[model samples]
Target: MMTLYGRRGWGSVLIEAQLAYYDLPFRFEEVDDLFTSASARKALARINPLAQVPTLLLDDGRVLTESAAITLHLADLTGRDDLVPGADAPERAAFLRWLVFLVTNLYPTFTYADEPTRFVADATAAKAFRARVDDYAQSLWRMVEHAAAAPWFLGERRSALDLYIGVMTRWRPRRPWFLAEAPKLHAIAQAIDAEPAFAGTLARNFAE
Candidate 1:
């Protein structure tokens, strides 16, 4: 079985959902807050220098970092296109485009804004930077909102993009903002939440 190193309710939920959706056998290794705990950072650094969550270790001991790379890797491992569109599938291009757009354009907002002091020394500067990042994240979400289709981000097909929408909607600017500003994406998130396959995973990571 694979081992996933992550903290609850972090970006690792995306990976957790997918692993569950595919019925893959994996164990979750909880890491303490990367931003606060020295030992957590030091321990994770040995496995992933970035000390980022969603760091997956295959049974063979090879480590995988970056959610996007791991997303593709999981698809390759399962050889099932359920969550990832196959190359010949028409949704392939759009899927690849938006997947990269999500990781490159939107996800970084949280990376920077979550712990702004890591990037900016001054408290005032960190606040301003976080505000800018939040504004930028909203704009990026608007772009996704426009491109979003009903039922799923890709429309009629449930892909990892839906998983991303579900988890990310819970982040900065959050579900309330998405409910009002990006109804389509919000609806997709709700749909994913209702998916029985991921019920346990989502509930565990996003417990109320």
Candidate 2:
């Protein structure tokens, strides 16, 4: 069985949701304290050099880190092109484009917003950086809103992108903001929130 080291409501939720979608048997190790606990950090470091959660210990013993990578791997393992467009599919390019945008452009902003002190030496500077990054992330989200596929990011069919965006939107500049600024993406997030296939997984991670 595969072991997934991650916390509730974090990026790892996407991977866990995927696993649930495929009804794959795996063990979940709650290492949500990786950033705050010494022992947890050390343990996570043994599996992920970056000391990040959402680290998957494969049955073969290889450790996989990074949320997007893990989600893609799960899709590949299940051969679920329905969830992740196959390599030859025309939608694959668009899928990658949006996935990369969220992982690269939006994910980093959340990192900085969550721990601004890591990037700046002074407290005031850190405060400013956090605010700036939040604004930037919001702007990027609006841009994506224009490109979204109404009830989903990849058009009529739902993909892993929907799951990811649903969880991510719950973070800073949350769903309420999206409801106001990015109506389309907001609808997409809500749709994912109500998706029956992922209902149990999502409720387990996000009780509210």
Q: Which lDDT tens digits does candidate 2 get at residues 137-172? A: 988998888889856888877888888888888898
CA lDDT, candidate 2, residue 50:
81
- Best prediction by TM-score: 1
Off by more than 4 A, model 1:
none
For each candidate in turn, the TM-score is 0.98, 0.95
Report the lDDT tens digits of candidate 1 across residue range 67-127.
Answer: 9899999999999998899989999999999999999989889999999999999999999
Q: Give the clashing residue pairs of candidate 2, or none.
A: none
